[model samples]
Target: MSAAHVISILSSKKARTMTESSQAMEQWADKLEAVARRQDTQAFEALFNHFAPLIKAFALSSGLQRQGDHLPDELVQDVMLAIWRKAASYDRRKAAASTWIFTIARNQRIDTLRRLSKYQNDISADEIWDLEGDTELFGEIRQSRVQTQVRDQLKELPVDQRQVMAKVFLEDKSHQEVASEMGLPLGTVKSRVRLAMKKLKLSLEALDL
Candidate 1:
């Protein structure tokens, strides 16, 4: 076969493959829109059947699965549930259906892992502190140590961030309450809190050393 003829054939095949992928993606987006607009059960089932294996493979490959673990069924369910809840928020103009759905899955997985880590941290803290110890003394010592660390870290933060952390944590105010009181955007308040949490986690970890 001539090299030119082979090159043309390969180009045609590549174009056909791209067109097929595009069509499949459009169908998926159409089904997602149907679910959003009409609560179409069939459309959802179609999505579930098509994407379940793909999501499971992604979870396994991404380290969400462990030794002897076949698939992250719970993670997949959580992602699907999130998709159902947030379907109305999907924008085709912004991203394709596969990208949108998988982004939801990725976010859901991250949130799940964070919650699990927090739960494990809580358990570890409980195990370390004698629950049976003098409850009052334990509380007092724990509160004192935490307050000292927080105060030290607060000094390290930027002035604006420090203020937000103080109002939210030290004052026992909700993020929304602090935002309203400070006249800052709620997002700014939340961002400061998240930054504070990261720094506090690091400082607290160092204290353990």
Candidate 2:
């Protein structure tokens, strides 16, 4: 085996179980896994088709577009490229492809948000781990498992509120900083943060997170 194939064989224990993958995805997944394990193009195409929409929806929902619901297809396109680039390291045992894809889009959305602002930063698993004060519980849940639950929770939030949360946590900008920077009133910023947290808490509960 080449160095890459060697690595995949060594790490298979931590990846998702291909044996349990859905019937719809199993045959293709097996082929893709083989191609991916060997560092070939076949795996890449399969991932792009299975995960692109999920990534796009995540980016849009995480506040990629504030002007309106309309998002640039190019943004999704770029993110899909990123997905293709990163797909090789994915461990199926850890997270389903969908959860992993959603997280990628979520992170991409945050990256775009940071670019819009004047922050210099370079970047989590459990939703609770992200929320602060729950590191232990966060650790118990698998990253992939949490992503599966968290992505749906995120989908239910209002667009405006989700943007505020993303800006605060993802961008590491304070509410005051965001308010001053975005030129929104301080009261509005506080209100939005509070609302985002409340909704997030509820979502977490719903997900059994």
Candidate 3:
């Protein structure tokens, strides 16, 4: 095909390929990338555990709980699917994975809440993908451009700071929770998290979306 013809065909496809792939095994990463683009069942599950709570917290915080009829899980799943379907447009540079994921959750939650009063009846109990709750470790198979950037920025920080961050941030523990678990002083845990955030914020200063 002509380059222009190939480009046009790609433009019409539902899933977009990565702009840059790192290595040969990285072709495997392309599979999940395609899954994300296609929003396959597997990819959705992998993503859900990672970002579900963030969405749930966002929804509950936004007052979705007042809806007697809407299950928080339902709302979160809806938001997550929307994210999956829209994955093609994801700009990883502009937002952290959680931030982008939660933004979708937030928007979906808003949509669900919008119909709160209107949904006066019970919806079917289908097995909605628990996008926000399941914590499957779809190990970092291969780094995409975005994941690579994140890894590099993370590498720039001290090892101890990184350890604290992995616990408190990625592990979803609070400063106190991490502190108690690690047997560190509460203040020390808080300081570590604060410092971690400062480092990340600085490293990511160029992009804030």
Q: Roughly what TM-score does model 1 have, to 2 decimal places?
A: 0.51
Which stretches of candidate 2 lie above 4 Å from their native place?
1-21, 24-35, 66-71, 122-209
Order of candidate numbers by TM-score, starting with the best: 1, 2, 3
| lDDT over C-alpha atoms for residue 5 of model 2 | 90
- TM-score winner between candidates 1 and 3: 1
Per-residue lDDT over 1-209 for candidate 3, one digit per residue giving the tens place of the 0 to 100 score: 79999988877551333333244334333433665666576756766665677667665654556665467677777876676676665543333355445545644554565455566434422224333332324323322334545544677888878888777654435788888888899998877766776765534345653
User: What is residue 44's positional error in candidate 3, in angstroms?
Assistant: 1.9
Residue pairs with clashing backbones, model 3: 48-131, 49-134, 52-132
Whole-model lDDT for model 3 versus the true structure?
Answer: 0.57
Model 2 local distance difference test score: 0.59
| lDDT of each residue in 115-177, candidate 1, tens digit only | 655354333322443322343423433443444455456567888877787676434368998
Best TM-score among the predictions, by candidate number: 1
Overall lDDT per candidate, in order of appearance: 0.68, 0.59, 0.57
| Candidate closer to the true structure by lDDT (higher is better), 1 or 3 | 1
Worst 10 residues of 2 by lDDT: 124-133
Cα miss at 74, model 3 (Å)? 2.0
Instruction: Give me the overall lDDT of model 1.
Output: 0.68
Give the alpha carbon lDDT tens digit for every residue of 1-209 in model 2: 69999889866843444324343334444544665567666666666666666666555544556744555355577667666566565555554455455556655565666566787655522231232222343332455344434544677888888887778765546889889978999899888877776654533345664
